[model samples]
Target: MSWIVDRIRPREAPSFSRPLALLVAGALFLENLDGTVLQTAAPAVAQEFEVAPEGVSPAIVGYLLAVAVAIPVAGWVAERFGTRRTFLVSVAGFTAASVACALAPNLLWLCAFRIVQGVAGAMMIPVGRIAVLRSVRPTDLLAAMAYLTWPSLIAPVIAPFLGGVITDVLGWRWIFVLNVPIGMALAVGGALLVPRAEHRIRTPLDRWGYLLTAGTVVCLTGGVELLRDGRPWLVATLLLLSVTLAAAAAHGMTRREHPLFVPEVLRIRTFRAGNLSGSVYRLVITGAPFLFVLLFQAGFGWSAAAAGAMVTAVFAGNLGIKPLTTPIIRLLGFRRTLVWSIVAGGASLLAFAGVHASTPVPAIAVLLVFSGAVRSIGFSAYNTVMFADVPRDLLPAANGLSATLQQVGTALGVAAAAAAAGLGTGIAGPEAVELGYRLAFVPLAGLLVIPLVGALRLPAAAGGHATARR
Candidate 1:
């Protein structure tokens, strides 16, 4: 009778908040899309403001910095204000900021408005994840996480090409303008779909903990951004300070009765694996699109549109593999699945390094498609398994900390890629530009070693609760 009940339970549909999950995914798409969409539009924006193209850097940096500052307090804000209210206000704020960005008459105003958008974004992402974590049953977690992971994967891959097309046809301002309707729809969806906070906690905000963590994020993110600018001394100094602050924050959080994020969350092996090794893995995949563009256009001398069109193979691969990711995870479990994904994904990078201008387009497309599929699978596993063992009470802290580390990974990825490529070029000298581009993938592939080691160390039965394996 017990065996029969267990068997029947596996076939029962897992009840979770699907509409809320979809709403959060859409909001995530908006946040991630905004971060990269403006990259290709910088020149057009500069022309309108009558400044050097590089002058637009402040607008971008300001937005990112504001996000870094706000993420630390996201969990507290949702608890204080209620998730449904916070989510609605965040969407509405972000949408209004977009309108302001579109109407900015100068670079100064644009930077200010972008900062507004960033603050809202910081609130939206972590809080939305908290909502999902609280609502999802263990059985439904993998599917819910798959929905959340898609925006992060899809947005960065398509943003460059989408930005180029939008700039060419609808104009650069339209980038922000288009978000208006989407924001309105999301706002309405949240009001209807998101459950009101079950209860609110009146925990006192930890001022010192917030400062320490925020400082660490600022230093780390700012240091990485400086790498791309060739400011080695400043980058080193900031990164050192970042490390110091991080240590201080960790030590202090453990002692505090009401810390910003409980340090004990990291004691969970699955959570720690996802944050430590998982972050390094994210750094590599995030950088791949940037490297691909440089290889296609700068190395091979292809046209911009041609390069972008070719890159769409990667996007197609990501989408094509989406439906299969969960089933694959269930079959192999997280440990074996992560190991294979990293190995295959790293091999794809090496294969990319060997490509030349004469390589068949079909060959390049197939390689990219394979890489994208593996990348998607690995990411979904890390995202889901990390939360598998976290207690319901700790979900908020875990989500907040995970979201913060993710931002660090994202902030460093492009800079690390650019720096690696630059080093490669210097070694090859001025005459062998293409060889330098090819050598860039060597180190990028090497970044996989950290995660590979971590994945192998994971217990074979790790994350069994989420996977439904015993």
Candidate 2:
């Protein structure tokens, strides 16, 4: 065991070329944090605005729809405008939206501002990724991805707690108010850190491709949101529409000379594993926090803060395991690291299914920490390898596609968790609420099989270049 650690240990510290990756990670944190924070603030916002809590759903759903609709065209926007300029504008726009949200006089006004925020957020992440991919050397790709991965890991876990604190002490509007300074700081950092691309691609925008792809995203995400509201007919119609558009979009990509995405990029086996199968991994991973938070509160009769505190254990694990993640990947290679992480992550979920009110707090925390750690490793590996073999020319399209799929995966995760939890409750009966929540983990763990199978099939040398194993 000691030899194993020693072997994976870095001989010297890893270094990044600039703070650009960190800036991008900050942007990702803000985007993720804003979405989750609103979940906590909904009731308060509704009260202040004199509406039903569900009335606030429009603001949330509107933002998500805007993000989904805009994501498919992010690459084109970056190319047409330029990466640095687009990123700066995105940050500025998001900040201004935040201000508008803070000052919104009514639900309608808040929804409008949130839509603006969504459009900016849609542009912020993928463009930042484009900047990073274009500038970072292949040797530093893993480290750069590591920087970008933490925000996604940490932000969602902490937001519920942080949002509750802010809403309780200061009020819900402060949630948006706080983004002003962070946004300003990120804009400054991006300007100083992110390099201008030496060249830009000026290909004509694939208008048809954009419409089909964007339609697919909107219908898929909006349908899922509609499901939670119990609008079965609307959800069904949107699901069918989404499927039709997706099939058309696939055909367009392969048939068109210049499609929104180059179909050939999927032929790169590593990228395929990360982009396609990795989404399955993300869906299960993203859903866990949602389940755990609800389980601790509704199932165990714990307070909201207490439930949130348990998630903080997972957050702690994400950061605690970060320094070792790259070394582990370097030592074992992406395939082995990913395989082990998936298996370990599944085992952690199974462990979660066994936890009950009588279980020791320390035991639950340790299990959560382990879950968070393996998830971190798996995510970094997937993100790095997704672009491992993509040609420099295809980076923009590849980044846009990956970003779009990732967003869809994230939206589906919470929905999946909700659906699974509902099924578990039905099976267990209302009298066994705790068991119902515990049962939710069973299916989520089972979903891991999809990615595990994908990992098992990966070539031993997958993502080798990122780790300098070539």
Candidate 3:
């Protein structure tokens, strides 16, 4: 125990970096919050718009697709426009789009505005990350990241409850309305707090790479959305098309002299292992909230506020465990921590499978809290360990790859959850959406079991080299 403490002692805190960190984090909170809040409110939006609850997923999927489409060009845009300019534009654009989203007249109009909001959101986070990386000395990078981590991580925790409250009281549109003031404040403060960078990378934009990658994500997410439309042939066609495009994109990256992503980054065994596994794990981590929110409301006869209150317990578990994350990873090591986390997450999803109309609200909340705790450990561990094993020179490309995959996983998780619910709906008959909702967890649990296999494949000391550096 003593040796573990010595192995990962805390570094000195940075001077006067709190405001900048919080500013960057606040933007991320808006981005992350908007997506999860919509999940809790999706059912209400469905009722108002006169569509199936699952039908609202296009707005969710549309936003994610926009993020995936824009991310490949984000670095180039930041470089050409400058970080401060790009960041300010992103905040303003996202705020303006929020206004459009709140006033959308129909589902089609809402999805269109959501796509615009997602494009701005795609730019917001990476640029904010660049600000923190440049502001701190190398010694303080880890500490600075801790500050950014809090707001981004906690947003999902609070959004379900917050969204429930807003949707119940003011209606779902107000969720978008509220972001207006927050974004306006952040855009103004960001100019004052974030340091201006003199040097910018004059990197050329990779147009072909962007097109292929964007095509792949769009096809995939769109395909997931189509499954609920009762068009199996179209869904199958789009899915197959997505696979082909993905393979072509990978092949193109290998052949290009200046690829969007460097080919060699995947050769690093630990980074590869972590990225691949983390995507599968994230599918569950991200999907469960969207899936469970609907299950509680549309299926179980719980009020939106009550469902949100239950989900709030997960947020408590997340905050309760935050201070312990670094020490626990240091103590158990990445491999052990990850394995145990996968086990815990799997058990949590399985617990959800056992819920029925008679399940106690208190009992469900307890499971959610426990599930959230295990998931927080897994999310923290998976996100950190990728960098631990990546070569220093390859850090940027590796992180880009990780971020892209995680984005896809996050989008796909919602799609998959909705599709699974649809399947259960079909099988249980049109009137049995609750039964369908109950059956949805079975597939999510199965998907989660996959990453455990990835965990076992790691060497015992995987990522220890980087962990030992501090």
Output the number of the TM-score-best candidate: 1
Q: Write the per-residue lDDT of candidate 2 for residues 393-419, one digit (tens) a residue.
A: 778778898998887787677777877
Clashing pairs in 2: none
Q: Where is the poorest 10-residue window by lDDT in model 2?
A: 10-19
Please give the lDDT score at residue 41 for candidate 1: 84
Most lDDT-accurate candidate: 1
| lDDT at 260, model 2 | 89
State in Å the error of residue 164, model 2: 0.7
Task: Show where candidate 2 strays beyond 4 Å.
Answer: 1-16, 226-236
Query: TM-score, each model?
Result: 0.95, 0.93, 0.90
- Residue-by-residue lDDT tens digits, candidate 1, 244-294: 999998888888899998888999999999889999999899888878887
User: Which parts of model 1 have CA positions greater than 4 angstroms off?
Assistant: 1-10
Model 3 scores worst on lDDT over the 10 consecutive residues at 134-143
**What's every prediction's RMSD, in angstroms?**
2.2, 3.4, 3.2
Pairwise TM-score winner, candidates 2 and 3: 2
Assess each prediction's global lDDT (C-alpha) against the native. Answer: 0.88, 0.86, 0.79
